[model samples]
Target: MSVTQEEDDPFPVDVSLFTDTFCQETVYRLVGQELKIRQVFGANLGVAAPVWDAALFLCHYLGEQSVELSGKRVIELGAGTGVVGILAARLGAVVTLTDLPSVLPQLADNVSANIPSVGWPTAHPTILPLAWGQDHQNFPSEWDLVLCADIIYLPETYPLLLQSLTHLCKSGALVYLSSKMRKEHKTHDFFEEFLQSRFHVELVNCDHGQNIHIYKASLRKDL
Candidate 1:
Protein backbone atom coordinates (compact mmCIF):
# COMPACT_ATOMS: atom_id res chain seq x y z
CA MET A 1 0.00 0.00 0.00
CA SER A 2 1.18 3.54 -0.79
CA VAL A 3 0.20 6.98 0.40
CA THR A 4 0.81 10.35 -1.24
CA GLN A 5 2.09 13.23 0.80
CA GLU A 6 0.59 16.71 0.62
CA GLU A 7 2.76 19.78 0.79
CA ASP A 8 0.39 21.47 3.27
CA ASP A 9 0.20 18.42 5.56
CA PRO A 10 1.08 19.21 9.15
CA PHE A 11 2.61 15.86 9.96
CA PRO A 12 6.10 14.92 8.90
CA VAL A 13 6.53 13.58 5.36
CA ASP A 14 7.75 10.25 6.66
CA VAL A 15 4.69 9.90 8.87
CA SER A 16 2.40 10.67 5.96
CA LEU A 17 3.95 7.80 4.01
CA PHE A 18 2.52 5.37 6.54
CA THR A 19 -1.04 6.69 6.27
CA ASP A 20 -2.41 4.17 3.81
CA THR A 21 -1.35 1.08 5.70
CA PHE A 22 -1.67 2.30 9.27
CA CYS A 23 -4.60 4.70 9.14
CA GLN A 24 -7.15 2.24 7.77
CA GLU A 25 -8.41 -1.31 8.11
CA THR A 26 -6.83 -4.13 6.13
CA VAL A 27 -8.22 -7.49 5.11
CA TYR A 28 -6.04 -10.58 5.32
CA ARG A 29 -6.67 -14.10 4.13
CA LEU A 30 -5.53 -16.75 6.58
CA VAL A 31 -6.57 -20.34 7.12
CA GLY A 32 -8.91 -20.02 4.14
CA GLN A 33 -10.78 -17.26 5.94
CA GLU A 34 -10.77 -13.46 5.84
CA LEU A 35 -10.03 -11.18 8.79
CA LYS A 36 -10.55 -7.44 8.71
CA ILE A 37 -8.14 -5.74 11.11
CA ARG A 38 -8.50 -2.15 12.16
CA GLN A 39 -5.21 -0.31 12.48
CA VAL A 40 -4.67 2.96 14.30
CA PHE A 41 -1.58 5.10 13.94
CA GLY A 42 -0.37 7.52 16.58
CA ALA A 43 2.86 8.68 18.15
CA ASN A 44 2.12 6.72 21.33
CA LEU A 45 0.97 3.47 19.78
CA GLY A 46 4.33 2.61 18.15
CA VAL A 47 4.65 -0.94 16.80
CA ALA A 48 1.42 -2.15 18.30
CA ALA A 49 -0.68 0.00 16.01
CA PRO A 50 -0.62 -2.19 12.91
CA VAL A 51 -0.50 -5.86 11.98
CA TRP A 52 3.06 -6.94 11.22
CA ASP A 53 4.41 -9.43 8.71
CA ALA A 54 5.68 -11.68 11.49
CA ALA A 55 2.13 -12.09 12.74
CA LEU A 56 0.97 -13.12 9.27
CA PHE A 57 3.79 -15.64 8.99
CA LEU A 58 2.82 -17.20 12.32
CA CYS A 59 -0.79 -17.40 11.17
CA HIS A 60 0.30 -19.24 8.04
CA TYR A 61 2.34 -21.68 10.10
CA LEU A 62 -0.59 -22.38 12.39
CA GLY A 63 -2.80 -23.05 9.37
CA GLU A 64 -0.58 -25.81 8.09
CA GLN A 65 -2.20 -29.22 7.87
CA SER A 66 0.32 -30.80 10.21
CA VAL A 67 -0.52 -28.38 13.01
CA GLU A 68 -3.51 -29.14 15.22
CA LEU A 69 -5.66 -26.36 16.74
CA SER A 70 -8.86 -28.08 17.83
CA GLY A 71 -9.46 -27.96 21.57
CA LYS A 72 -6.14 -26.25 22.26
CA ARG A 73 -5.90 -23.36 24.72
CA VAL A 74 -3.94 -20.51 23.14
CA ILE A 75 -2.81 -17.10 24.34
CA GLU A 76 -1.32 -14.47 22.04
CA LEU A 77 0.99 -11.84 23.50
CA GLY A 78 1.18 -8.43 21.81
CA ALA A 79 -1.69 -9.30 19.57
CA GLY A 80 -1.78 -5.91 17.80
CA THR A 81 -4.71 -6.46 15.44
CA GLY A 82 -5.82 -9.85 16.80
CA VAL A 83 -5.27 -11.61 13.45
CA VAL A 84 -3.29 -14.56 14.73
CA GLY A 85 -5.42 -15.22 17.77
CA ILE A 86 -8.59 -14.70 15.77
CA LEU A 87 -7.46 -17.30 13.25
CA ALA A 88 -6.70 -19.72 16.05
CA ALA A 89 -10.17 -19.25 17.46
CA ARG A 90 -11.73 -19.94 14.06
CA LEU A 91 -9.67 -23.10 13.81
CA GLY A 92 -11.18 -24.34 17.11
CA ALA A 93 -8.68 -23.16 19.73
CA VAL A 94 -9.80 -21.36 22.82
CA VAL A 95 -7.82 -18.13 22.42
CA THR A 96 -6.88 -15.07 24.43
CA LEU A 97 -5.58 -11.96 22.66
CA THR A 98 -3.46 -9.78 24.90
CA ASP A 99 -1.46 -6.57 24.78
CA LEU A 100 -0.79 -3.41 26.76
CA PRO A 101 -3.92 -1.73 28.13
CA SER A 102 -3.73 1.03 25.51
CA VAL A 103 -3.79 -1.43 22.61
CA LEU A 104 -6.79 -3.41 23.79
CA PRO A 105 -9.47 -1.25 22.20
CA GLN A 106 -8.26 -1.67 18.64
CA LEU A 107 -7.41 -5.29 19.33
CA ALA A 108 -10.87 -5.89 20.69
CA ASP A 109 -12.42 -4.20 17.66
CA ASN A 110 -10.52 -6.51 15.33
CA VAL A 111 -11.62 -9.54 17.33
CA SER A 112 -15.24 -8.44 17.12
CA ALA A 113 -15.05 -7.85 13.39
CA ASN A 114 -13.58 -11.24 12.57
CA ILE A 115 -15.35 -13.38 15.14
CA PRO A 116 -19.11 -13.60 14.99
CA SER A 117 -21.46 -12.88 17.88
CA VAL A 118 -23.20 -16.21 17.42
CA GLY A 119 -22.75 -19.54 15.66
CA TRP A 120 -19.07 -19.79 16.54
CA PRO A 121 -18.62 -23.42 17.58
CA THR A 122 -15.32 -22.85 19.35
CA ALA A 123 -14.60 -20.47 22.18
CA HIS A 124 -14.26 -16.86 21.14
CA PRO A 125 -11.04 -15.04 21.93
CA THR A 126 -10.83 -13.14 25.18
CA ILE A 127 -9.37 -9.65 24.82
CA LEU A 128 -7.33 -8.55 27.78
CA PRO A 129 -4.54 -6.27 28.90
CA LEU A 130 -1.32 -8.18 29.54
CA ALA A 131 1.91 -6.35 30.23
CA TRP A 132 4.33 -9.22 29.80
CA GLY A 133 6.12 -9.97 33.09
CA GLN A 134 3.93 -7.69 35.18
CA ASP A 135 0.68 -9.43 34.23
CA HIS A 136 1.84 -12.99 33.56
CA GLN A 137 0.95 -14.11 37.05
CA ASN A 138 -2.62 -12.94 36.63
CA PHE A 139 -3.15 -15.49 33.88
CA PRO A 140 -3.19 -19.23 34.39
CA SER A 141 -0.24 -21.27 33.14
CA GLU A 142 -2.29 -24.12 31.74
CA TRP A 143 -2.32 -22.87 28.16
CA ASP A 144 -1.53 -25.41 25.46
CA LEU A 145 0.11 -22.78 23.24
CA VAL A 146 1.52 -19.27 23.59
CA LEU A 147 1.80 -17.05 20.52
CA CYS A 148 4.01 -13.99 20.02
CA ALA A 149 4.72 -12.00 16.90
CA ASP A 150 7.33 -9.25 16.33
CA ILE A 151 7.40 -8.42 20.01
CA ILE A 152 11.16 -8.75 20.58
CA TYR A 153 12.29 -5.49 19.02
CA LEU A 154 12.81 -3.63 22.28
CA PRO A 155 15.91 -4.98 24.00
CA GLU A 156 15.03 -3.52 27.40
CA THR A 157 11.90 -5.68 27.55
CA TYR A 158 13.86 -8.89 27.00
CA PRO A 159 14.08 -9.89 30.62
CA LEU A 160 10.46 -8.99 31.25
CA LEU A 161 9.34 -10.98 28.21
CA LEU A 162 11.46 -13.91 29.33
CA GLN A 163 9.87 -13.78 32.76
CA SER A 164 6.42 -13.88 31.19
CA LEU A 165 7.35 -16.71 28.83
CA THR A 166 8.83 -18.78 31.65
CA HIS A 167 5.70 -18.38 33.71
CA LEU A 168 3.41 -19.24 30.80
CA CYS A 169 5.45 -22.29 29.83
CA LYS A 170 5.56 -23.63 33.38
CA SER A 171 2.70 -25.98 32.62
CA GLY A 172 4.30 -27.21 29.37
CA ALA A 173 2.67 -24.78 26.94
CA LEU A 174 4.31 -24.72 23.53
CA VAL A 175 5.33 -21.21 22.36
CA TYR A 176 5.47 -20.12 18.77
CA LEU A 177 7.22 -16.75 18.36
CA SER A 178 7.53 -15.24 14.90
CA SER A 179 10.02 -12.38 14.65
CA LYS A 180 11.54 -10.32 11.89
CA MET A 181 15.31 -10.88 11.86
CA ARG A 182 16.16 -7.23 12.10
CA LYS A 183 19.86 -6.80 12.77
CA GLU A 184 19.63 -3.60 14.78
CA HIS A 185 17.04 -5.09 17.12
CA LYS A 186 19.39 -7.93 18.10
CA THR A 187 16.49 -10.35 17.72
CA HIS A 188 18.84 -13.27 17.37
CA ASP A 189 20.52 -12.65 20.71
CA PHE A 190 17.27 -13.06 22.61
CA PHE A 191 16.79 -16.56 21.23
CA GLU A 192 20.48 -17.54 21.48
CA GLU A 193 20.92 -16.22 25.01
CA PHE A 194 17.85 -15.64 27.20
CA LEU A 195 15.31 -18.02 25.63
CA GLN A 196 17.58 -21.00 25.01
CA SER A 197 18.76 -20.81 28.60
CA ARG A 198 15.29 -21.56 29.99
CA PHE A 199 13.42 -23.22 27.17
CA HIS A 200 14.08 -25.68 24.39
CA VAL A 201 13.94 -23.50 21.26
CA GLU A 202 13.80 -24.68 17.68
CA LEU A 203 13.53 -22.88 14.34
CA VAL A 204 10.40 -24.21 12.67
CA ASN A 205 10.00 -21.87 9.69
CA CYS A 206 11.43 -18.84 7.90
CA ASP A 207 10.06 -16.42 5.34
CA HIS A 208 13.07 -15.10 3.50
CA GLY A 209 11.37 -12.31 1.64
CA GLN A 210 9.87 -10.90 4.80
CA ASN A 211 12.87 -11.73 7.00
CA ILE A 212 10.62 -13.44 9.51
CA HIS A 213 11.60 -16.50 11.54
CA ILE A 214 9.21 -18.66 13.51
CA TYR A 215 10.53 -20.53 16.54
CA LYS A 216 8.83 -23.17 18.61
CA ALA A 217 9.72 -23.32 22.28
CA SER A 218 8.89 -25.30 25.38
CA LEU A 219 10.05 -24.93 28.96
CA ARG A 220 12.99 -27.02 29.98
CA LYS A 221 12.21 -29.74 32.51
CA ASP A 222 15.21 -28.77 34.61
CA LEU A 223 13.94 -25.20 34.86
Candidate 2:
Protein backbone atom coordinates (compact mmCIF):
# COMPACT_ATOMS: atom_id res chain seq x y z
CA MET A 1 0.00 0.00 0.00
CA SER A 2 2.98 2.23 0.34
CA VAL A 3 3.51 4.65 -2.54
CA THR A 4 7.09 5.43 -3.31
CA GLN A 5 8.26 8.85 -4.30
CA GLU A 6 9.53 8.84 -7.86
CA GLU A 7 10.92 11.87 -9.61
CA ASP A 8 8.88 11.09 -12.71
CA ASP A 9 5.55 10.91 -10.93
CA PRO A 10 3.20 13.48 -12.46
CA PHE A 11 0.93 14.14 -9.51
CA PRO A 12 2.01 15.82 -6.32
CA VAL A 13 3.02 13.44 -3.57
CA ASP A 14 1.59 14.75 -0.34
CA VAL A 15 0.87 11.46 1.38
CA SER A 16 3.45 9.93 3.61
CA LEU A 17 5.73 7.19 2.31
CA PHE A 18 4.15 4.67 4.68
CA THR A 19 0.70 3.33 3.99
CA ASP A 20 -2.00 3.53 6.64
CA THR A 21 -1.33 0.76 9.12
CA PHE A 22 -4.91 -0.37 9.44
CA CYS A 23 -6.09 -0.13 5.85
CA GLN A 24 -5.26 -2.25 2.83
CA GLU A 25 -4.93 -1.18 -0.78
CA THR A 26 -7.45 -2.42 -3.30
CA VAL A 27 -8.19 -1.77 -6.94
CA TYR A 28 -11.42 -1.18 -8.85
CA ARG A 29 -12.42 -0.52 -12.42
CA LEU A 30 -14.87 2.22 -13.32
CA VAL A 31 -15.88 2.80 -16.92
CA GLY A 32 -12.75 0.98 -18.07
CA GLN A 33 -10.54 3.00 -15.77
CA GLU A 34 -8.49 1.35 -13.08
CA LEU A 35 -8.29 3.00 -9.65
CA LYS A 36 -6.40 2.23 -6.50
CA ILE A 37 -8.35 2.51 -3.25
CA ARG A 38 -7.78 2.01 0.43
CA GLN A 39 -9.95 -0.26 2.48
CA VAL A 40 -10.71 -1.16 6.14
CA PHE A 41 -9.75 1.81 8.19
CA GLY A 42 -9.07 1.50 11.92
CA ALA A 43 -9.89 5.13 12.36
CA ASN A 44 -13.36 6.69 12.33
CA LEU A 45 -14.22 4.74 15.46
CA GLY A 46 -13.16 1.47 13.83
CA VAL A 47 -15.44 1.75 10.83
CA ALA A 48 -14.26 -0.35 7.87
CA ALA A 49 -15.46 1.74 4.96
CA PRO A 50 -14.57 1.42 1.28
CA VAL A 51 -15.96 2.31 -2.11
CA TRP A 52 -18.43 -0.49 -2.74
CA ASP A 53 -19.41 -2.24 -5.99
CA ALA A 54 -22.67 -0.31 -6.23
CA ALA A 55 -20.65 2.86 -6.52
CA LEU A 56 -18.68 1.50 -9.46
CA PHE A 57 -21.94 0.44 -11.06
CA LEU A 58 -23.31 3.95 -10.64
CA CYS A 59 -20.16 5.48 -12.04
CA HIS A 60 -20.44 3.27 -15.08
CA TYR A 61 -24.00 4.36 -15.60
CA LEU A 62 -23.04 7.99 -15.31
CA GLY A 63 -20.31 7.50 -17.86
CA GLU A 64 -22.54 5.60 -20.25
CA GLN A 65 -25.23 8.27 -20.12
CA SER A 66 -22.62 10.99 -20.77
CA VAL A 67 -23.84 12.81 -17.72
CA GLU A 68 -23.20 16.51 -17.92
CA LEU A 69 -20.71 16.73 -15.08
CA SER A 70 -18.74 19.63 -16.46
CA GLY A 71 -18.77 22.82 -14.42
CA LYS A 72 -21.04 21.35 -11.78
CA ARG A 73 -20.38 21.92 -8.09
CA VAL A 74 -20.59 18.55 -6.40
CA ILE A 75 -20.39 17.42 -2.81
CA GLU A 76 -19.96 13.90 -1.59
CA LEU A 77 -21.30 12.90 1.83
CA GLY A 78 -19.64 10.18 3.88
CA ALA A 79 -17.06 9.90 1.15
CA GLY A 80 -15.07 7.05 2.61
CA THR A 81 -12.29 6.97 0.01
CA GLY A 82 -13.72 9.82 -2.07
CA VAL A 83 -13.65 7.73 -5.26
CA VAL A 84 -17.04 8.70 -6.69
CA GLY A 85 -16.51 12.38 -5.99
CA ILE A 86 -13.01 12.23 -7.41
CA LEU A 87 -14.29 10.54 -10.56
CA ALA A 88 -16.83 13.31 -10.92
CA ALA A 89 -14.01 15.81 -10.67
CA ARG A 90 -12.09 13.94 -13.34
CA LEU A 91 -15.15 14.12 -15.53
CA GLY A 92 -15.13 17.92 -15.13
CA ALA A 93 -17.27 18.59 -12.09
CA VAL A 94 -16.10 20.86 -9.31
CA VAL A 95 -15.96 18.32 -6.51
CA THR A 96 -15.54 18.72 -2.81
CA LEU A 97 -14.43 15.59 -1.05
CA THR A 98 -15.88 15.28 2.45
CA ASP A 99 -15.68 12.84 5.34
CA LEU A 100 -15.25 12.86 9.09
CA PRO A 101 -12.42 15.19 10.15
CA SER A 102 -10.26 12.28 11.20
CA VAL A 103 -10.51 10.68 7.78
CA LEU A 104 -10.06 13.72 5.54
CA PRO A 105 -6.30 13.39 5.15
CA GLN A 106 -6.42 9.88 3.77
CA LEU A 107 -9.41 10.70 1.62
CA ALA A 108 -7.53 13.66 0.19
CA ASP A 109 -4.54 11.49 -0.57
CA ASN A 110 -6.58 8.92 -2.43
CA VAL A 111 -8.27 11.65 -4.43
CA SER A 112 -4.99 13.25 -5.38
CA ALA A 113 -3.59 9.94 -6.57
CA ASN A 114 -6.48 8.69 -8.68
CA ILE A 115 -7.54 11.93 -10.37
CA PRO A 116 -6.32 12.12 -13.95
CA SER A 117 -3.60 14.52 -15.04
CA VAL A 118 -5.09 15.30 -18.44
CA GLY A 119 -7.54 18.21 -18.54
CA TRP A 120 -7.66 18.61 -14.80
CA PRO A 121 -10.34 20.92 -13.52
CA THR A 122 -9.38 24.57 -13.21
CA ALA A 123 -10.50 24.56 -9.61
CA HIS A 124 -8.88 21.60 -7.94
CA PRO A 125 -11.21 19.49 -5.84
CA THR A 126 -11.17 20.21 -2.10
CA ILE A 127 -11.11 17.93 0.89
CA LEU A 128 -13.21 18.95 3.87
CA PRO A 129 -13.95 17.60 7.30
CA LEU A 130 -17.65 17.08 7.91
CA ALA A 131 -19.90 14.89 10.01
CA TRP A 132 -23.48 14.19 9.02
CA GLY A 133 -26.37 15.67 11.08
CA GLN A 134 -24.03 18.28 12.54
CA ASP A 135 -24.24 22.00 11.85
CA HIS A 136 -22.91 22.85 8.40
CA GLN A 137 -22.68 26.64 8.53
CA ASN A 138 -19.12 26.60 7.22
CA PHE A 139 -19.85 24.37 4.20
CA PRO A 140 -21.13 25.51 0.83
CA SER A 141 -24.73 26.75 0.83
CA GLU A 142 -25.71 24.62 -2.15
CA TRP A 143 -24.36 22.08 -4.57
CA ASP A 144 -25.41 20.97 -8.05
CA LEU A 145 -25.25 17.35 -6.99
CA VAL A 146 -24.70 15.44 -3.78
CA LEU A 147 -23.16 12.01 -4.28
CA CYS A 148 -22.83 9.20 -1.77
CA ALA A 149 -22.08 5.48 -1.89
CA ASP A 150 -22.48 2.62 0.53
CA ILE A 151 -23.53 4.91 3.37
CA ILE A 152 -26.80 3.21 4.25
CA TYR A 153 -25.48 0.37 6.36
CA LEU A 154 -26.09 1.88 9.77
CA PRO A 155 -29.65 2.43 10.92
CA GLU A 156 -28.78 5.37 13.14
CA THR A 157 -27.10 7.24 10.30
CA TYR A 158 -30.08 7.11 7.93
CA PRO A 159 -31.82 10.20 9.31
CA LEU A 160 -28.61 12.14 9.61
CA LEU A 161 -27.58 11.26 6.07
CA LEU A 162 -30.94 12.40 4.74
CA GLN A 163 -30.78 15.61 6.72
CA SER A 164 -27.30 16.33 5.46
CA LEU A 165 -28.34 15.63 1.88
CA THR A 166 -31.36 17.89 2.21
CA HIS A 167 -29.28 20.67 3.73
CA LEU A 168 -26.51 20.77 1.12
CA CYS A 169 -28.51 20.12 -2.02
CA LYS A 170 -29.55 23.07 -4.22
CA SER A 171 -33.10 23.59 -5.44
CA GLY A 172 -33.89 20.84 -7.94
CA ALA A 173 -30.46 19.31 -7.46
CA LEU A 174 -29.96 15.63 -8.04
CA VAL A 175 -28.84 13.32 -5.25
CA TYR A 176 -27.14 10.10 -6.31
CA LEU A 177 -26.78 7.26 -3.86
CA SER A 178 -25.70 3.64 -4.00
CA SER A 179 -26.05 0.92 -1.44
CA LYS A 180 -26.15 -2.82 -0.94
CA MET A 181 -29.49 -3.48 0.59
CA ARG A 182 -28.82 -4.92 3.98
CA LYS A 183 -30.91 -7.39 5.92
CA GLU A 184 -32.27 -4.71 8.25
CA HIS A 185 -35.78 -3.58 7.44
CA LYS A 186 -35.16 -0.21 9.04
CA THR A 187 -32.66 0.73 6.35
CA HIS A 188 -35.22 0.08 3.61
CA ASP A 189 -37.99 1.81 5.52
CA PHE A 190 -35.86 4.86 6.20
CA PHE A 191 -35.09 5.32 2.53
CA GLU A 192 -38.74 4.84 1.57
CA GLU A 193 -39.94 7.44 4.08
CA PHE A 194 -37.16 9.91 3.45
CA LEU A 195 -37.62 9.78 -0.31
CA GLN A 196 -41.33 10.34 0.18
CA SER A 197 -40.74 13.42 2.32
CA ARG A 198 -38.43 15.48 0.11
CA PHE A 199 -37.52 13.66 -3.08
CA HIS A 200 -38.81 11.89 -6.15
CA VAL A 201 -36.76 8.72 -6.05
CA GLU A 202 -36.26 6.09 -8.70
CA LEU A 203 -34.16 2.98 -8.99
CA VAL A 204 -31.55 3.48 -11.68
CA ASN A 205 -30.12 -0.01 -11.68
CA CYS A 206 -29.23 -2.96 -9.51
CA ASP A 207 -26.47 -5.53 -9.81
CA HIS A 208 -27.72 -9.02 -9.39
CA GLY A 209 -26.20 -11.40 -6.79
CA GLN A 210 -24.36 -8.51 -5.15
CA ASN A 211 -27.41 -6.73 -3.76
CA ILE A 212 -26.06 -3.45 -5.04
CA HIS A 213 -28.49 -0.73 -6.06
CA ILE A 214 -28.10 2.70 -7.64
CA TYR A 215 -30.71 5.42 -7.23
CA LYS A 216 -31.32 8.90 -8.52
CA ALA A 217 -33.55 11.40 -6.76
CA SER A 218 -34.25 15.09 -6.99
CA LEU A 219 -35.30 17.47 -4.25
CA ARG A 220 -39.06 18.03 -4.25
CA LYS A 221 -38.94 21.76 -3.49
CA ASP A 222 -36.88 24.61 -2.22
CA LEU A 223 -36.64 24.52 1.55
lDDT value, residue 171 of candidate 2: 54
* Best model number under TM-score: 1
- State the lDDT of candidate 1 residue by residue for 122-190, as single tens digits: 886899898866889999999999999998887767888999999988899999999999889799999
Query: In model 1, which runs have C-alpha deviations exceeding 4 angstroms?
Result: 1-22
Cα deviation at 17, candidate 2, in Å, is 25
Pairs that collide, model 1: none
Q: Give lDDT per model, in order.
A: 0.83, 0.71
RMSD of each: 6.4, 8.9
lDDT of 2 by residue, 33-104 (tens): 677887655423134255567677778878887778889988887787777887888778998888776667
> Over all chains combined, what TM-score does candidate 1 have?
0.88
